[model samples]
Target chain A: MTGPPDDETRDRIDDELPDGEPPEDAPDGATGDPVPVADGGFADESAEPHEPRIAFYGGKWASTVPIVFFIFWAIVQSGVLGIGDTNGLVIGALVGTILGMFLVRGDWKAYADTIFEGMTQRVAATAIVAWLWAGMFAETLQVGGFVGGLIFAADALNVGATTFPAAAFVLCGLLATGIGTGYGATVAFVTLFFPAGVLLGANPVLLFAAILSGAVFGDNLAPVSDTTIVSAVTQDADIGGVVASRFKYAILAAVPAFAAYLIMGSVLSGASLEGAAALRESATAPGLVHLISMGVVIATAVAGRHIVEAVSWGLIVAVAFNLAFGLSSVADILVFTTTSPTPAAALPFVRVGETAGVGGSLYSGAIGFFPLIVLTLLIVAMAQIMIRGGGFEAILEFLLDSVATTVRRAELTMVLGTAAINGMITINTAAEIAIAPYIARLGEKFNINGYRRANILDANTSALGYIFPWAGGVLVGYQVMVGPDGLGEQYGPEMVVNPIEVVPYVFHGWFLVIVFLLAAITGFGREYIPDRISEEVSRA
Target chain B: MSRFEKFLAGWSLRSSTPDYEPGDVIEVMVTGAEGDRAIARIGDSTLRIEGAPGDAADTRIRVAVETWDETAHRGTGTYRETVGESAF
Candidate 1:
């Protein structure tokens, strides 16, 4: 297959086409020019009259109203209310879209059409596809006893209670980096390691923070990670280049983070020594097979294989290992059972006597990301509306003209801008997508390297997403902490870890942001790619 | 380059062609072509020009560098609309 389109081809295509803007003379609410195909070639004749096209409606300030409202509502709903519900976010997006209608000068139909156009855009679809595959892979690994394997390794090491948190941090970071999903790491570590650490008398808050810190490391460095993918693709940097460039920064921050955990782990172990022997005995050998499964993903990704193919291979191997070693049954890996009151019985695939609940690792793993996938698509749709309305351009002009007069200032803007967006938005991937365009546009103006831009964009996006109490990563981790099968039942309700308490302890996440900020100001670990434009086109 | 230089190559942002600046018009030999873009050679460095019409490859072309990223040793150039007869 041919490589990605070259820079001149991309610029030509972008210059000729106005993504959704109406013509100056077009009637109110009327669809503007037909979409222009790349090559400065054919028009998309299939576009219907009522189809919404992106058009500038008013001044920059007016265009920004929708995005401003969305951010405000998000902060109030998720941050203030401390509710991380996907449904609530979806509602906020809908409300913001409706509110944006008044700011447009066109007919109501044109505005409505724009929303539809934004929702089904290719960028949003691409992210959703990756999330589905990642979700499945993560879930499968979990079902195949991946976490159990880590537990076994920890037990075999015979670590003291004081050192357990630090050890757990490193292991969780490695697992997250390999798997490329912080949420998956949070679920696994909180469910398995948190309880184990508690039993060994480790401080609950510190232990939980260490797990989050590991997640931030993985989210920032892992090639398969959603934030990493978004940052690389949006900035037009090769995934391999982005990953390689980020290694120094990730390691620089991790060294201090690991040391902190080690010191805290020793200073904070408060558990009585009586129950440690029983906990160690419960660890098993079969779980260790998953270490091979994680290795498969990392190896394939680093070899420059497509991410989807790499993860698929990892998922298949995990399932095979789980079954062949008798670690879990095939039915346990995937099963469908039916009962009298259940509607599943009517389906042809349902056996009369077979159990029909969605069980096993494979089925739940892929299905687990459905809500997040939908949420990402809707948020992108809202972002598209903001982009077409000139809100993004207005913000870009302000930053470029005022704050980013010098290269150092520009890099700092990229860092702080990405961080600010991710902080207000509970979902990191969505925030990355929203802010990626600004980074690309602004970075290119200063001739910043694609690798540098991707690194800065992703570092802050990953860090802010975990450090804040309202963040999806922290909330997800907290939810699993208090769930029925979580520490609440195992160690009583008093042992439940609150999301707020863990925020201050997420040292890795906080350190990453600081590292990037310092890198921006001091030019540490900063490199610009001379002469070469990014290979991938900016999707935003 | 010394061994220490090689080791730090990937970690540092030193430019291979430090003298090139944005908007400088120059003539370069097209060394390679990919799709609609042309790769032009200048001394030891390479420049990528997008949207150059076909057949511009394997020929000398006068272009203006729109942007130059020194550390990456690459720049985006636009084909000059007019050149003096002796430009080549």
Candidate 2:
């Protein structure tokens, strides 16, 4: 009786409503005509059955008020004031959502239901799952002294390897871009390359920035990237053509960013050669065994396995390596210590310690992202509210009717509009999805080809997601730097880079944004609908 | 276009209003509709399609161009058939 209604009761309930549409949270292709969603907007009513929409006091524009306030709050908190505290962002999102309820014109339940709809969205869930698994893997490697191993190996090999920030940039960029995951690559690189470079006399801030830049490079161009796919599909363009057309932009930014990292790497050698030599003494050969574990993840991700599966494989391999090679004890990787461990002391993961706690790499790794994950969910909920309430549509309509009267103005509108949305919604892919319809509609209006539209949509989304302090990519990377058990306590305070500090140094992110702006103004990469047809089928 | 050509595409400057000749059959999305007419705005060029369904907005349809004025950047077309619907 306390549960959801039974079939018979549900039928009765459905029959009672005038339109027979329930007020359930079906934001994503749910029971009714597909209303706009953060990932995909406005499914054809002729194609799908839709739910009744929740109305606001002032039409669709009213739906965006709460999110608009939240963005203003974020701008004031993170951008204008330079406050990087994520918890503050959480409070901002909460207050913003509360503000939304007052704007609902009809039953408040519809508004409440939309919150649940957004919270349950697959986009938020995907990020949470990947962050959790990646967190554990990162910590386990740290426990195994993977950083020290990298330092010793780089020192012995005498090749640049982890000693050079430029090398780290290239490697991290290749892995992330190739695999289509900037966040995952950032975690892996920060866990491996960040400390290795730090100990080998590279500037810690520069190293972190290089890793973030690498992630931006990959996320913008990766065919398998969610942002890329969303941009392509929403714009009605083939993924292959979109990728091909955007190549020049990616490379244009990358080449200079690469040189910047190289020059900056040498000039900003914050650590002494003597200090690096002294630090390498702490490393041992056994620690290097975890490279196999690292390889497993990079390989699986490149093979296009689900991120969860790839990280799981990496976790398994790392644990096995730690056990077989004696790099770390079982209790160190996963220990369940209780007030009285007598009963479970015999268990492999159970150990008697002075303090009673769940202290292990896996546990701590996942624990680090708790605040960030909460913030991500709340932010995504805000994006969903905007979509359901018509704020997204309002923004697009404004751009189309008010700003984009000419061809040049239209392209500029696309560039600035995408940036504004990505800037507001901290989750890059969610932002891209939410803005895809606008991009498609507006770009189509001007006959701006799909390749240019997709490129514009993704480049801004990818770059902004990593650039901002409150952005998911930046926060996720910062969490790892905070010693998300994957890298360990040995990393300490010196290696940590505040999310704000890395902003200027994320060379590729800035470079990419600059390229799009230039392209828009000069029409460098502009194409028309008559340019050429994309492939027959949608690659995405 | 070939793989190598993709890298070379869009090198030259493109016009604001592109022209499509008469008898050209093109597949385009009907972005909006007014009364009995449907519109497909390509770049700065506008195409008014005839015999399009009332619900043609946001749906892809095939059209045969009837006439085009290059200077005016506008054209008229006859709707052939519905090709697809909006992706979302």
Interface RMSD of each candidate, angstroms, one decimal: 12.7, 6.9
TM-score, candidate 1, is 0.66
Error of 1 at B39 (Å): 23
Tell me the DockQ of each model, to 2 decimals: 0.09, 0.37
lDDT of 1 by residue, A35-56 (tens): 3222111122221111123344
lDDT per residue as tens, model 2, A478-500: 77765334333554556666677
Q: What DockQ was computed for model 1?
A: 0.09
lDDT of candidate 2 at residue A482, scale 0 to 100: 58
Docking quality tier of model 1 = incorrect
The reply for model 1, stretches above 4 Å from the true place, is A1-81, A121-146, A160-165, A175-212, A222-244, A264-281, A340-356, A424-441, A444-451, A468-503, A526-540, B1-7, B10-88
TM-score of 2: 0.82
- Residue A100 in candidate 2 has what lDDT? 86
